[model samples]
Target: MSEPALTKRGRPGYDQRAILEVAVAAFNEFGYDATSMGVLATRLGLSKSAIYHHFSSKEELLEQALDEALDGLEGVLLEQSAQVGPVIDRLAAVLRGAVEVLTSRLPYVTLLLRVRGNTDVERAALARRRAFDRSVSALVVEARDEGSLRGDIDPRIVTRLLFGMVNSIVEWYRPEGPEDAGQLASDVLAVALDGLRVSTRSTGLDRLDHR
Candidate 1:
């Protein structure tokens, strides 16, 4: 038999996982709406038909990509590390897990973050993201009720602030850059949960005398 045909990129076979990875990166670099099947194929050195063979459409590819990112995050909630600890510690553990997932799957997470819910897949992804936020917020509420976390701030606001700080990592994090995931996770937990106080003692309104 003749040698197997090669794609324009001169490859004999395509790896589905690798293809999805390239697609995710392209979706991040160029807006998903602006990136087309043909453009993705060209970027991957494959024919449009080759890509079609694996993904029915760009929407399917996007769904798969976001799924990878969302799954990693959702998986964190199920970890024993996050499930059995004190409420405050559980919340901190989850935050660290989120950082690890984001750092490990940077492109997919980055793409998931940028999606604007313009399509059904994107909207579904957004719903899942909101669910995650609510779950984390529940932890904050529990910690406040347990008196381990400050109760003055609304739990929802605490969740927003904590994730707002963690999520901001997507904007500047580089897998090849100086920081590693372990260190980043520690630093994030330190700043978000521990704060900058010289001591962990109460310093805000809780410290004031009501008299």
Candidate 2:
């Protein structure tokens, strides 16, 4: 395919990254099913041919966007801290890394969370998501076995509640807002890990019941 025309600044008018960014935004704003190449071209002020120059189809675009989100989450599992530390510490690293990914790629992650398996691409993304969840659940189970986490709660429930808190940030988090990614990750860990950690001393509830 012929290269896209250059702008006055001598940059390709719309590189694949730029097109993908616009496409992802549109996909997030309008459901992916509702978004078409014509809509993306109109948003880019270019011909449909220009979009095709970079991506083969809307499905290709969706696949790339979902990969952007899924790859980041999967990478967290491969991090040194996640792979090498104590199980509870590894779980904490995974949680903190996920918050980083979500905040850094808010649009992509938001689209990922909204996926419902309508297309083959969506189903593939869902499979990867399930795999990621299973990895997390395994870590939770390991931590509980190590006596770092409470034994009563099911590991699967812990995985869901932990990510539920992380995933919900998409609804309200803003890049321009006061809390940066670090603060947000810290706050999530503080609340989630503090409650989740096995207590060394009597709890407030234990004291109240005793009184």
Candidate 3:
């Protein structure tokens, strides 16, 4: 078997998905500061101009990848919130779908997590992330109103804790790991909503208003 050589220009040998996969891997291994279009092109077996044709800049690629993850979450929330169910049940379904996204689109979501307002693109991504968090927090508030979740903790604070734990899965999850994504989501929900014991929490918004 012979090794493949980098082809010169005109349409590039790789497709958008191929480029993104290589780019994301580079970003993951090298961090955003260290990765460059030249380096990414070299890694992907394409020329610089070829890569540029697909992406205006390295930051554009980063932004697009972040958008992919954000868009997935936005879609999940939009669809799940419309469904009829007990508030906690809806939450569990939302989380299960979120886990599916986190697993299926791990690279994109992983890149989303790594953004830290270092540049204009990163700042935009951070803003989008906050928007998503706010939306999720709204759901938590709704869940609280429905009396499906504990009311002692502030809803906004609890929302952050819930998402912090959900988002933490990217740190330890393996695509080929023994546990499936749905199972992981369920396990997470179990710990967050249920706990170690099997106490059946009921639904209704009977919480005394602290506001």
lDDT of 2 at 54: 84
Pick by lDDT: 1 or 2, better one: 2
Compute the lDDT of residue 72 as modeled in candidate 2. 100
Candidate 1 whole-model C-alpha lDDT, 0 to 1: 0.88
Measured against the true structure, the TM-scores of the candidates, in listed sequence, are 0.89, 0.88, 0.84
Query: lDDT per model, in order?
Result: 0.88, 0.92, 0.80
Error of 3 at 160 (Å): 1.7
Error of 2 at 142 (Å): 0.4
Cα lDDT of model 2 overall? Answer: 0.92
lDDT of 1 by residue, 75-172 (tens): 99999988996988898889999999999999989998888899889899999999999999999989888889988898888889888888899999
**Which segments of model 2 are wrong by more than 4 Å?**
1-12, 196-211
Identify the runs in model 1 with alpha carbons over 4 angstroms from their true place.
Answer: 1-11, 200-211
